[model samples]
Target chain A: MPSTAGAALPERSRDLRAFAGPVVEWAIWIAVLAWVFWQTQRFDREIAQYAFGAAGWPRALCIAAALGATGQLIYRIAEIRRGRAAVPEAAGPEIAAPESAAPEGQKPGLWQRAKHLPIFIFPLIYLYLVPSVGFYVATPFFILGLLLILEVRTLRALLGVTCVVYGLVLLLFTRFFYVALPVGRIESFYDINNAIIGIARYGM
Target chain B: MEQFLDGTFNLFGDGQAVLIFALGLIGGMLFGAIPGVNMLTLGAVLLPFTITMQPEHAVMLFSVIYCAGVFGGAITAILFNIPGAPENAPTCFDGYPMTMQGRSGKAIGAAVSCSAIGGVASAVLMMSATGLIASWAVRAFGPQEVFALIFFGLAVSASIGAENLWKGWLSVFAGLIIATVGTDPVGGIPRFNEGSFFGLEFSSYYLSAGIHFIPMILGFFAVSEVLTQAMHISKGTRERPKAGLDFPTIAEFLSVRWTMLRSIVIGFFAGILPGIGATLAAFLGYSQAHRWSKKRANFGKGELEGVVASETANNAATGAAMIPLLALGLPGGALTAMIMGIFQIHGMEPGPLIFVNSGDLVWITFAAMFWANLFIILLGWLQTKTVVQILRVPFRWLAPGILLLAVIGAYALRNLFIDVWVMFLAGIVGYLLRRSGYSAAGVVLGLILGKLGESAFSKSMQLMDYNFFGFFERPISALLITLGIAAIIVSIINEIRGADVQKALMD
Candidate 1:
């Protein structure tokens, strides 16, 4: 009986791990809906006579989201329960592979997910820099940083690709389309920028 | 026929018109082939330049771009797993598989051919039926009917989440909730902007403007893809396959002729409906193909018919989407919405009366579309010769380039820094939802249709003395509502039966 209990432990744990993502999603949905429902109370109740006021659609949507999330939670739980019993070891590799390869102990932590952090962070940093540094000034650095994160080894290839892409965007947005890319702190920079634009448009 | 001939003569009579058509086709194709940049972005960028050209030339340029952009998205979808645009999502289901099978050239050829055929067929349909369809649609659809139709669109879009009906419904409702952030369509009163909710102060200005779609699309599809690819960067490079301009033979084309024809019909009708864009048309077309095909089991595993179905329907919707714009002054999708702006800028209002007021311009535009389709076939075939080489570039190098384009595309929308932040937030949300097996397309469809649906519902309420159930009293409205309910039931049944939900539907 003791040996039997030991064998069942890992299987049970695997099932729990599988349910973790769905549980978190459900919690997020519920929280969002709760906030939405609370906000609906603030909408003016007297504006429209028909079909509920400005809050009507939002309130209905919130309720529907709550119900849907609840239903999904139940369905996912059932699937996990059924899957553990019905799925066999002798089935196809795609189904059996996960069970056989299950980690013996604790799941990987935040450190394991850290590899994806830089790629996600790059966009955020780029956006923050765009307004102050301006698009033309910010883009090359942005591309250079992303390339380094993506593991472009050689400096030559990195600089070459960055320059080409930046030049093309500069020509297209500034010269051809005349899109007002932010000028940043230096107002006198416009003279040089306009000269480059002139060269692109009508030749020096 | 006379008008078409006259339009054709006028188009060729001027070298400038021909040059503009060629440039629009090439430029749109290039933009659409990039993963994060779409034709609508290209249209927005070129909109300023159109100010300098004749109104006829501007219209012609936009028409060419619309046709080429729709077709160009399939190129990357076939060669890479990434879709160039949302409408190309379905194409990636089989297209990337075909690439894995070293049939990239053949898949691309079929995609281009079918897309051109679908575009030409819809253009013909538009020429023949736009006047009649417009007049009838304007007369037949009141706010109540339009609301019902939008509700039906939402239902059909939700049905796309066949793997998880509840999650799909949740996504749809979440999208609707997001749409309600701005001022009410009827009352002009802000609903969700208060001092603080959930410990975050809601900005009245941001809430009033609401979220833009392009930024959301870039985040959901492009930014999320970057994160996903980053995780897999350690997998090392795979072997590259040989690809070229290998157009399908007559027999090969004939084999999928029936599929293409059905897709064209499906796409044309889907386009006529307001707010139902190319993405939904592609999904519906692919789903119908899976339902009808004998080898449905082989669909996601590199089936040629899958590529044909998606590309054909998406491009076909391009022409059909223009019908409402030309007929009722109602823009169908982002691309048409921008085109409508261009029309207004050029002093040619696009309504039923446009045919009378700007008959020559209308004929010229139709002629341009025809020429544009032909031009895409030629230019696309040439593009295939070199585009396949993109796979040879290391993904590590390509990833950063894509990221740059994604940023630029987001910023280009309104040149607003806040939009960029919105895109980043949307990307995180998209990544989470995708990891949880929820459909991002459902969320996007909901976003697209939500505003239209709410406004129509509110207007209809005003029309019918506040009785919500009165939506079902009208014949067309009743039919639409019944269809919407039936679609939900069918999707639920499909889910219960454990049908093989195609990844194309999960976009």
Candidate 2:
């Protein structure tokens, strides 16, 4: 199938992606504020000697942050209501670089905008598995998975990176720093960890 | 003076001492530049092996490593945006930006010279009045005064690169709140620890010890940065950042001399405090540089002064930290504590008696550090010449390595998987915040400064019977806090008068 840019999209639909970006950012800001407010509210009441107790400092911070975010959001919305592109005036350079470089004449849907999803998700999976599958076992696959997702298909690049990164991890963490690193609970994974440790510590 | 001359002679004339210094320089730079491993790790690994060595050689080795390690971190911070240690975090703010701007060589050069300046100056101060300064620092800078310094640092930090004052403050507040997650300092109450589902007994148990800095720093600076780069690749917007050896000229060094000196003073003094050390010194140096700069607008956008301020102060702190350890028997930080362990292994205690009983040893250690700092200029430039080659590698290859390093960096802090999880989570948060016109640096500043300030705040409160106004009774504390408040007010006024406060935030 053609990429989003390869298939020409309707101008209105194309603009919708641009329109949705700020809307999503706004919603995220609001959600985060709510969560922070709720989290601070959950702390137990204050101690007498403490300056407003365990809850005071965080609660004070929560109020201050909420006020700032709320104020900024309100200003942004008001500026937009007056038919001004105020966000573009000072909107994030971090967001700008990618947004400006996006393929033209395309309708960038949520998926189009979120091409970084795999990069973000892969780490979570790798992190969750490390404790169970062992560091030495899981790392190569983790690296391979990232390389594949990022479209680095060259055999030389893939093998070179995998070996160098994995070797460095093994050498620096285990052999040099002497970190125990996680061995894992499953018998197979345990053996995998042991085999590597034995090879590293005592030789093959 | 005789001891000093003998110490200098020992380092230069003795083959063993010369060999040890060379070993320390290489080992420190190697370990300190690695993602998760640092000089402290190197020191810990070497501690058991140091027993057979002579006492003077053993102690001298660690001092050289300490000086070199602090500067080693700056190289990684400037080139890769991967601060090898927490103290190098501020360097990343400006240094990495310069790398992207193809000024990596200049940034590295600034880091090298200032680090040398800081290290040498601090060594001089440490040798000249170790006992006197340690005693004066202890008496003058109590909890209240320390709180004032942190308050001032945080206040200036919010305005460092932030265009919108409120956005910066919001970022700071969020950081302060996030820092309160593990536990309340005074009461040991688990503030944000997850409770059981449906009344089943559950919590992380150890969270009362609080969030670790390693995970948070890795998440914010490294992991999130990878995501930004990945986004560009996936969107077909990939562009290789500029990297070269356009090192700074002598004129550039002269330009930042004031910042260099000021930061060294801050870093040296900050290092003398028991719990607070190089990390605070670095952040404070960066913020103070921003506060005093004629071109404040250039900071965090790749200012040479920013790199000079942070690297110099952090290196300076290494020598200053030994002051308390040698003079008052107090460990200024973890690395110093390890050096104390070295002293104990050698059947020597590091108090006023150490100087009286082993005057030659103290001078030798001091001379070793002074010389070690001088060598950093050459070694650091060599590193800059070589390390910039990595920038030629594609982001696809570098990102995975960085992430893997991030995982280990986080977990190794306490060998807790929770830290790794936190690192990923913070990365997600950091990426989102940066895209939405928020200041991640402000958040970081708040987290570190707030953590240090909270304990001081608690102590000051108790010292003054919980009366908030009583803190201002102390002249130093009063002056610092007043300055902080004035800065906040001035920034707010600037915003009201239609200043471009939103640009830095949005940028």
Candidate 3:
């Protein structure tokens, strides 16, 4: 049984990828640790000695992270070898879990397992597009796409939300707050950004 | 006494001052409740407008906003896990859980009342004795003490949501690493931020400001939350929050009287520090609440005391933040820094001399804050009844809006696109970390305190000839470090003696 801390328990895996989630997370962390340790060598060698503290704080933290992760890994393996999770009823809150563990029912296909990918990917695309296409032009499309991705099927619901969200942002952020939104480099996006800015700033 | 009276008269006597108060109250609460936008945004937008207004009104307006804004974030933190500002992050721990359990009204009610109590109490303390207290308080905290305090904060934060102590510390270590991303505090050397590591070349000057915790908070709390809910929605396991305003009874407020008092003291002291403000205060309050709470296990599980503790301490910090700004000419946080700008715009400096030169302005602003905190209770009640209605909106409609708000909030921090990138990236990382049973709260705590800790640690080491034990030489630092060490030991003991340890090996 999972504790109340909301640690994503590695679901009783239905596939190899789902089962290997914990191992993969460890690998990524170890890679990060290795990179950080390597960077410690680049500190201004003259003034950056640990005694004087330049690369020292990060180095110390990286070392601690490695030890903590390695210890957990060893302990987890021991628990598995013992044939059950030793969830130590009072581990005191934080525990270990594999990422994005699928539901523990019958085997789901890749699409079912990866349903949450769009949430991540959509934001990345939105971020990537915002700078190039300008914020005002790209936001409506982004909201519409997100609405559809979230299973919002009604056309009225999609457009209404898209328009309301976009309009509210334009009114409050651009008009009232006077924040500088990203105007794109392309000629058309530039014009769109300017037009929106003009309309938002002065009205009509 | 005469200056205080005159300031009170000045604020209430002028009809324009009354209008300014209304605008600040309404504007502050509105901006404060919005997910991505904070009251600082309101302050920044109003900065130029302040130049055209009377100095006292301008100064009073920011003060009121500070009080109302800190309180406003609590509403969102309760109704949604999205904290409107960094200070309200801790409120999300229990407040959102309470909401999930369909007790948002009770959580909001406690938050509103405690926030008012914290704000008004701190304001009263701040008003009559600014000169004596600020002069004494600032002198007491040196680098050694500051480092010890941050050390204590981080140590206690390690076990916040972690059942496994190792996972909690790892989360904190990860945050410390992230905090070291931009620049080394001692020598200003850029750390893991950019440049070549093992023949890898990267250049991003924006790393100079480092990863602001605001983006990290928004990312972890808001963006990751939406993703989690989206997954749940897909799974058909989503729970809609039932709405009902259950204002805590008089007994409920009295129940946490100790928490309220302790938080006020904690918030006041924390606020007087130049860099440490409401965020630290809120976390400290929450941490201490968990420590002393009779219902400690219920803390992250939607405990009312959790909301009260966090909201009170943060709002308490709003008043205490003014202490340094008014008394020492030191801005405690971003909003206060802007208030300092307002002070300068009026051709006045904030130190002890300001008490003599512009005592009326200082006192009038104080008077307005006093009223603003009380007014927030009324405003908060109205907002609660209305904003709680957000729970009625389909989570699908609310979800995308939260993400959009997260984007705007992150970018608004420094007007940098890198912040947006950082926020999105944090969302992904946060999702993974949360899934792994890592405490995002621990990471945030470490991030919030890491820079302060590193800088203060370095300075303390220099002052004490790099001796680790030198911290114990100073009484205050010694006391703090001891308390921190004690907390770690208790956590270790708990882990060792935990209930199901033998079940794993024997089964």
Candidate 4:
């Protein structure tokens, strides 16, 4: 059945050709293991000569792991051949449909969806900006931004919940956990931050 | 052993330990009840206070949190269909079904009781076994064995990612690479750090910036859930959890006796393996139980046995994981690793030396685990009613509140803005991968075990002359390797003849 599916595809199309799930899983692993092995190749080869040192166990383990990894790569290849192949399902509910029907733009295909790089990249940008904005400053905005994207209703509820939640967290961590929350430069704001810091450092 | 016995007696004698246990019980109940809050965050949030505590007492607080976290997750899972942890995801299957049938109280009761039993059983196993294992492990000086043990750990994790072995391996390798990003432990040279970003070597290795697990955890479990919840809310209809608890009948529990016993054993054994942790133990135990269950067809549709297997195995894994941690000074899971870190920062090295050098602390910690498990039962039951109430909050209010807490929790880890970003990215990845049928737990476990396996393997290489057999030469290492091989065969056999095994076990 998979062979027929594969044959039906355009011969030159590199993407979306039918392949077994196990095959795809292995192919991805081999690529990763190969990269790791290549990264350690020089040191791994050099370390092969030295013996009977304080470093003996750690180095040997690495090479053994590389070997184990290599063995797995081979096994995966074999397993992939024995299994039925899959082409990403083109049929699935759309995300934009009714909430019970589908989530926003989610479909069954994998390769077609990887094109949306922005979704994956957004979080990284958020993390980079968090400490600079400070917990108090950043959390409400993060909450508000995420809610808006998901199309949450009622701005009043969102604002109320965001403030209450953020305020509660500030009370808990600062008062209870005593975490040294980041407070960017400001002489006037220094004391409050310091008091929080002091509590975190000593009180808890 | 004598000291361990004495420490147990001490907790009862002084009542201070009991008070600590109470705090842990309450904390675990509350943390587990809330959707966004998890044990790791609770542990981290509570860590600073423990710094001034006696090592044993400090460990007790965290241990209570661990045991309770497993059971606590079911509160919302049963009532709201929201899993408190990734491990608890399976719980929502039967758990919520029982709730849907208006047996919410009974479901919570059975879950709590089974979880407590698993917890206490593993604790008993750990107490009895730790001394014996520690004595042997402490005396054994085979670098080959250590390397092999690490290999065994890697294999367990690798096997868990059966269909997606490659992605699993990549996750492990990524962790290994991350482990090497800092200064080489033996070589003492910065291998991965390009240099100071602005004249300061801003790296986990050079700057002693620890890789904060809590932030990562919060990001993956808490933050991701919030985003998913947000998406669900926008869809119009939201799940509102019903409140309350029910005590189980004697017959109901008696029928599950064999399952409970089997799960406890599985949990205990899984716990013994380093880095395997409760989630896998619960998963494996539940899978086995499901395969063998008389009501196999009722599993995903919400069988009581499903909840029993998952909860018991997870809870048992908690205590069992500590066996390796205490006996060998090798951490059995991520949370224990954090505790191990605390021990190191406090100038206590966990290996064989710990048993001999820090005998008092060792005994105390072992004793603490035992009592903490017992305390988890009392704690779980006490907060049973209170916790079920939290499930009553409307999804809209609860979702935003949880989202806020997730942000705070992520930010609290290292007080870094960047971790918040990591959480966000992980959330998106988690959501996307989950939608694609890839398990988020797999990813997290991969990220975790991958690094440990790499470091241990590398350490072995640095010692031996790249001889692969170094892993097998040591007796324990060889045993673990054998177990890994056998487990793979068993998993395969089980998968192939799944129906037969299910029939035989159920019968």
- Candidate 2 docking class: acceptable
TM-score of 3: 0.91
Q: Could you tell me the lDDT of residue B214 within candidate 1?
A: 67
On lDDT, the leading prediction is 3
Better of 1 and 3 by TM-score: 3
In candidate 4, what are the lDDT values of residues B1-507, reduced to their tens digit?
677788777766667877887787678767776665678778776777777877777776777777777778877777755567756755665676676555677778878888888987887777677767545544663454544554554554442322234333444444444445334444443443333333454334322343344445555555555555555554444444456467678999998888898889877766666655676577666666765678755664447887888788888888777766766678866578778867865777776567678777666666766666666666667666666676665555665566556666666545655556656666776565434434344445444544455456556765665776766767777787787677556654543443333223322
Best by DockQ: 2
Model 3 C-alpha lDDT per residue in residues B56-131, reported as the tens digit of each score? 8899999998898888888888887888887898888788878877889899989988999999989988986788
Better of 1 and 2 by DockQ: 2
Q: What is the TM-score of chain A, computed separately for every candidate? A: 0.72, 0.73, 0.74, 0.53
TM-score of each: 0.86, 0.90, 0.91, 0.70
Better of 3 and 4 by lDDT: 3
User: Candidate 1 regions off by >4 Å?
Assistant: A1-24, A81-111, A185-204, B35-37, B41-55, B77-86, B159-163, B191-204, B235-252, B295-302, B328-359, B500-507
| Tens digits of per-residue lDDT for model 1, B1-507 | 899888898898989988898888898898889765678778887888888898888988888888899888888777755567778877876786677667888889888888899999988988888989877766888889878877876776573422357766887787778778778887788766564755866555665677766677677666765665565453232334446446678898888889999999888877777776687688778867876887765676678898999899988888888889998899887778877888888777888798898888888889889778877788878887789877777766676667666776767667776667877788788766655546555676677678888889888988998887898899999998998898887876765555634422322
User: Which candidate, 2 or 4, has the higher lDDT?
Assistant: 2
Interface Cα RMSD of candidate 1: 6.9
**Which runs of model 2 end up more than 4 angstroms from their true locations?**
A1-51, A70-85, A89-107, B161-163, B196-202, B500-507
Q: Positional deviation of B199 in candidate 2, in angstroms?
A: 10
- Once superposed on the true structure, which residue ranges of model 3 sit more than 4 Å away at CA? A1-28, A48-53, A70-85, A88-108, B1-5, B195-200, B499-507
